[model samples]
Target: MPHKYHESQVRRTDAVEPSEEEKQTQEKPAQKEQSEEEKQMREKRRERTERGREVGAEEADAGEKT
Candidate 1:
């Protein structure tokens, strides 16, 4: 008896080649230097995000305790 499914019956898609422009963009772009003020602002934003997460967790725990 023949099997109900066969690998040969399955269709496969071929990989498309990237255009010249796409290939160029695929390469890593130059990184811009960040100024001191930019760096400080990024750090402050990160700290605030983390603090918010901590407060949310504490509130969840308080709800579970009560």
Candidate 2:
């Protein structure tokens, strides 16, 4: 069999290398700094989420008592 293209013409993904910034981002853990407003929003959302779970738990406990 004869190949139409040469070796250099073929694209190889493995040859691609990550840059220094990319490598650093991967190596170092990301630290997200949220603003005061963002922090308050996140806290409120978290409390709202846990509130549902708490309600469910209370209902389950009440059912067990019946």
Candidate 3:
């Protein structure tokens, strides 16, 4: 005896378009603004993080020497 299998089929359909209001909301959002002081603080935090990494690496190398 031989086994029998059923075949599957798919139907094509047109895509639904978005309404005017939906299109507007889907558009790009407004840019955000940051204050000068906030920007400066952010940069300072980044510099401190990098400096900390360098110091840690130096300490590790020194420890290995002892």
Candidate 4:
């Protein structure tokens, strides 16, 4: 018997994925607090919710009056 290495076995490389340095770089950029745009969106959502509640309240009042 003799040791035989095939072309496929000899031509193999490291797994195609992120390296440790790449992983480290990605990990360094931590998610910060809510951005200004996010804050504005949240404020707009709150305003819309408040408006919906007020509209519902007014509709109830109108129903009682009718």
The best candidate in terms of TM-score: 4
- Whole-model lDDT, model 2: 0.67
Clash totals, every prediction: 0, 0, 0, 0
Query: Can you write out model 4's per-residue Cα lDDT over 1-66, one digit (the tens) per residue?
Result: 855876676556343567798886777645333366678899987876676687886775575579
Model 1 global lDDT (CA atoms, 0 to 1): 0.62
Query: What ranking of all candidate models by lDDT puts the best one first?
Result: 4, 2, 1, 3
Between 1 and 4, whose TM-score is larger?
Answer: 4
Worst lDDT 10-window in candidate 2: 27-36
- How far is 8's C-alpha from truth in model 1 (Å)? 64
Candidate 1, residues 1-66: lDDT per residue as tens digits? Answer: 988656554332212566677776666343223356678899987876676687886775575579
Residue 50 lDDT in model 2? 78
Indicate the residue-level lDDT of 5 in model 4. 70
After TM-score superposition, the amount by which residue 8's alpha carbon in candidate 3 deviates from its true location, in angstroms, is 55
Give each model's whole-structure lDDT. 0.62, 0.67, 0.59, 0.67
For model 1, the stretches where C-alpha displacement exceeds 4 angstroms are 1-34, 57-66
Off by over 4 Å in 3: 1-34, 57-66
Instruction: Note the residue pairs that clash in candidate 4.
Output: none
TM-score comparison, 2 vs 3, better candidate: 3
Per-residue lDDT of candidate 2, residues 1-66 (tens digit): 999777766544434777688787776544333356678899987875676587886775575579
lDDT of 3 by residue, 1-66 (tens): 743533332112211466677776666343123356678899987776676687886775575579
